[model samples]
Target: MARCFSKLTQTSVRIEVGGGRSFDCPMLPVSAIDEFDGIREMLGSVDKPETLREVFRRLREMAARVLPEEYAPGLARFTLDKLIELVAYLIYGDDDDQPAGGQAPADAEDDLYEAKKK
Candidate 1:
């Protein structure tokens, strides 16, 4: 008896980091909405994940907090790229990081996540 939510990619997201490693990430309960908000607030300007590792760490922590009874510390490890995809799926419900046009960089206009320093 489960109700689907638009914010979630699916009932669960499969995180694969290769080398025979994988983690099944379950969608957080509605009560965890505040946790999602906290994550968003901590990560300003979602152009890219400059603090990608930090975001992953928090997500792992959140999963543990919500499902403490099933938390397995040993299965919490995640790679940078996989973590980035996971973050996108959890936040946006789809791991499509490519621009709508889906074109490669030919000039500055193609620098989707590139930010210049002042």
Candidate 2:
């Protein structure tokens, strides 16, 4: 049997970097990974600790292209830690408010079980 697959919706999210800073950027499309040489190289060298800075710089640059011009200064003011956080959001589509790895809270299973009993 053939099953129908619906198209996934892509959206832009505003990332707040703190101190009244924010960036409106869209999710990185899967195609962009192959289109940019720097991104391709960066992904290939994730295991290399020595090139971490370069990898982050590449991500920031890629993000800059996708973000609006008004955010250029805010992007420049960002620290390495912030850049890494943004990269994770871009790659995993996980917002800061959510739990890491997109895992449900520990008590969620218990809540589900209780709901089923009702």
Candidate 3:
């Protein structure tokens, strides 16, 4: 049986970094595809010095979209690694993608999604 793509649902994500700061992100899987691809492409094209700057701009803009207004202002404080994780979570959820060390690169805690229905 074929299903309607428009009927897909989203999961709520909570990103809690150090200092008791956390942002509740409601992310849709369908919407994260473009964001993930863009960042991955930019990350792969790291020849020129300007690529980093361009990616940082893109990363900031993307984070700003999901963050609360108060947290938006603190976007600059977030490391690029954290921003990438947030976007990756939006796309992949928590699927054991973590490195062998079982941790991410930042002080950020893991916010996993409950398993989706089969």
Candidate 4:
């Protein structure tokens, strides 16, 4: 069935956020992905952006629900920066903010997404 086939594409990704903090986050369900992209598109269309906090808060709440129990306390200790990093890692597998090895700080590139679009 198409429904079951789509579900097969979803799976958990495990990320270690240093300091012994790690979590397994499942890929966003199709409905959640629709909502995610919708909110993003709406924000881009808006002249004065609000509800940014609500958007990230909803993501954090959803992520928290699926996180392993071992890392529950760590989630409580996460600052906004760390939470965003976790979210990015879950979705993209690596943080774009972090410079790659052997790359000079000034030479580091942030063009991965652009390259993917080609």
Q: Which is the winner by TM-score between candidate 2 and candidate 4?
A: 2
lDDT of 4 at 11: 48
The whole-model lDDT of each prediction reads 0.49, 0.57, 0.60, 0.50
The sequence of per-residue lDDT tens digits that candidate 4 reaches over residues 1-118 is 1111222333455555588664446644444555555655654565543565565565576556666666656765666556656654455442222222333222322243346668
* Best prediction by lDDT: 3
Give the per-residue lDDT of model 1 (tens digit) for 33-91.
67667766666645566675566677766655423354347336666455444544643
Please report the TM-score between candidate 2 and the true structure. 0.46
The CA lDDT at 107 in model 2 is 45
- True-vs-predicted CA distance for residue 38, candidate 1, Å: 2.5
Q: Candidate 3's error at 4, in angstroms?
A: 17
**37-87 per-residue lDDT for model 2 (tens digits):** 565566576777767766666767766766667765576667766765665
| Each model's backbone clash number | 0, 0, 0, 0
Better of 1 and 4 by TM-score: 4
Q: What is the C-alpha local distance difference test score of candidate 4?
A: 0.50
The lDDT of model 1 is: 0.49
Distance from true position, residue 40, model 2, in Å? 10
Give the Å error, residue 93, model 2: 2.2
